[model samples]
Target: MIKRILLALASGALFAVGLVVSGMTQPAKVMGFLNVAGIVDPARFGPWDPSLVFVMGGALLLMLLAFALTPPSRQHPERKPWLADKFELPTRRDIDSRLLLGAALFGIGWGLVGYCPGPALASLLTGGLDAGVFVLAMLVGMALARRWIGRVAA
Candidate 1:
């Protein structure tokens, strides 16, 4: 348990540091990444920042490697994580309102503030006042969404 906890904390800290170093904690960096139109126009939103694209590509590459390396066996069908005894992945494949709403909310929030949960959390920890506000609002939004979704699902 102690090992798992320490591992988790170390992994999270590494992720946070990566975000900071990659400039993900900066709203302008994200906004510049999102400025696809600025790529063609150049005068409107400045040169499109392609650093985030590289970061995302690297992450995707890692994900593909992980998936390729550790795919669960169909014959066994009882895959378990190394640290945990049982690992149950989300089985839902059907696209429902929850999925749609969640995606929409995430995109909108990211566009509006340029701070996704990871970056927001990182920035908040690094003493960014704007990120602090964003994190607080994000927490409130999450709680309200949880209550609403629970009621709806029930």
Candidate 2:
């Protein structure tokens, strides 16, 4: 149990580091980048303020390189415990209403708060009161949702 807890914490620490390094922890910067309104100021530094695009492109390039280096199933048919199964696919056939509804809610929250689920948890490590409040509210919302869904099912 302790080992699992430590592993989880380590993973979270790494994620937080990633968030900080990627500049996702700054709410104002993220909001400015998302809303496409970063270039109007006469005191602005660049012609287009393309820092966000460069960061995103670098992330995408890293992901693509990782995918490219992964060994293909055709080369090694045996499945490893740490690696996902080669032929595993989603069990769903059609787009479910629940999936769509959840995605819409998530997107709206992200847009309004400039903080997605990952970044919210990562922010807790920085020991800020806003992060604490956001996390508490998020947990309460999740609990209420679960209870309401349970009642509806019954």
Candidate 3:
């Protein structure tokens, strides 16, 4: 258990460092990336930021490598390394109204705040009020979602 906890902490620290290094912790950089109109008209909307694309590409590459590295499961022989085991994998019924609603809400929040959960937590290290607020709000939102979702599922 302690080893798992330490590994999780290390993983989180690495992720936070990556977010900061990749410039994902900055709202302006993220907003710039989300500026689709800026792609066509840099003068009007400002230059389109491709920072996120590179960051995502790097992440995808790493994920592929991780998937390649993980050994195949014995019980669920057909399952891909990247995917959950047969018992853990969600069914089509799991993709319900709540899932769609949550995804839409997450996208809207990301667009408006320019900080997803990972970057928001990483930005906390900068000691910025905005980042602090965002992180707090994110935690609160997560707690609320857990409560609500648990109740709904029950």
Candidate 4:
């Protein structure tokens, strides 16, 4: 348990640092990078930022490596995670209305504010008002979504 907690802390700190260093904590940078439509139009390409492409690509590569490396805990008890006893993975593979609504909401929020939950929380260390407000709003939205999605799913 202690090892797992420590590993989680270390992982979170590293993620926060990556968010800051990758310019993800900056709303303008994120907004610029998210402007994919502008990239297709030469006239509107000025606001588009391509720097984030590398960051996302590296993340995807790392995730692919990790997923490919990890095996089923049931058949590989000796190869379980170093920090935890077992993997707590999602077994559900089928997509539902809940998944669609959640993804839509996430994309809308990111496009409008350029602050996903990770970067928004990481930006709080810089004492930015926008990040603070965004985090607050995100929390409230999460609460509302919990109750709302529950009803919808039922």
Candidate 5:
């Protein structure tokens, strides 16, 4: 249990560092990336930031490498890396009303705040009031969702 806790903490710290280094913790950078129409530019194709693309590309490359290294069917526990044992490939889900609603909500939040969950948490380190408020609101939203979903299911 202690080992798991330590590992979780270390992983979170590493993730936060990566967000900061990648400039994902900055709302302006994220907003710039989202300006696909380049309305904020005089060149008409300007104001488009490619930093998010490169960051995502690097992440995808790492994921591909990990997937290649750990085939799903490999049963040689002794030879497999820890990730092979710890993580499973996610199964696909069909588009449903819930999924659509969730996606819409996420997109709306991202566009409005320019900070997803991970980057929002990372931004807390900078002691920014906006980040703090966003994080607090997010937690409340999550809790409300949990309760509402539970009631509906029950």
Candidate 6:
């Protein structure tokens, strides 16, 4: 349990660092970029704020490096434990109303909040009263849904 707590804290810290470094913490910047205003005020930053491109490139590069460094899984390992497992795609083909409704709800929430689940949690940790409310409401919604599902299943 202690190990899990430590791991969660470490992961949260890493995510917070990523959010800060990526400028996701700044809603104004994201909103401004979305607005597409023609002002282009380069004077404010003065060549220092290459936040967007650098963040994306760095993430992609890191992912590439990780994939390259990791060796391919072997079916029959020379060691005790086998490295490979059976792989298969989802067999469910039906696009039920639940999936569409969930997607629509998620989109509506995101459009209104400007903070998705991960970033909302990050913002709550980093400091945002709005984010705190959002997280609480999100948890309530999740709990309600789970209760409803349990009742239905029962």
> What is every candidate's alpha-carbon RMSD to the true fold?
3.0, 4.4, 3.5, 2.9, 3.3, 6.1
Q: Which pairs of residues collide in model 1?
A: none
lDDT of 5: 0.85
Off by over 4 Å in 6: 1-9, 31-58, 76-94
Q: Write the per-residue lDDT of candidate 1 for residues 74-125, one digit (tens) a residue.
A: 5546654546656677887899877898999999989988999999999977
Instruction: Summarize candidate 4's per-residue lDDT along 1-154 as a digit string, tens digits.
Output: 7877888999999999999999999999999998887777848566578999999999999988886786657667545564556768899999987789789989999999999999999999977999999999999988998898799779
lDDT of each: 0.87, 0.72, 0.85, 0.88, 0.85, 0.68
Considering summed lDDT, which 10 consecutive residues are worst modelled in model 2?
78-87
lDDT of 2 by residue, 62-85 (tens): 868766676656666553222444
**TM-score for each prediction?**
0.84, 0.71, 0.79, 0.83, 0.81, 0.63
After the best TM-score superposition of candidate 1, give how far the Cα of residue 63 lies from its true spot, in angstroms.
4.4
lDDT of 1 at 84: 66
If both were scored by lDDT, which would come out higher, candidate 3 or candidate 4?
Answer: 4
Residue 76 lDDT in model 2?
Answer: 63
lDDT by residue for model 3 over 1-154, one digit each (tens)?
A: 6765787799899999999999999999999999989989999889999878999999999988886777667775653533334335555665768878989999999899899988988888976899999888888999999998899889
lDDT of 6 by residue, 16-117 (tens): 889876777665554443433324654663323345566778889997876566554565232221222432359999898877988888877765666667
**Each model's backbone clash number:** 0, 0, 0, 0, 0, 0
Rate residue 131 of model 2 by lDDT.
Answer: 69
Q: Pick the candidate with the highest lDDT.
A: 4
lDDT of 5 by residue, 54-151 (tens): 99999899978875776444466433445335545568767888889989999999988899999999999977999999999999999999999999
Ranking by lDDT: 4, 1, 3, 5, 2, 6
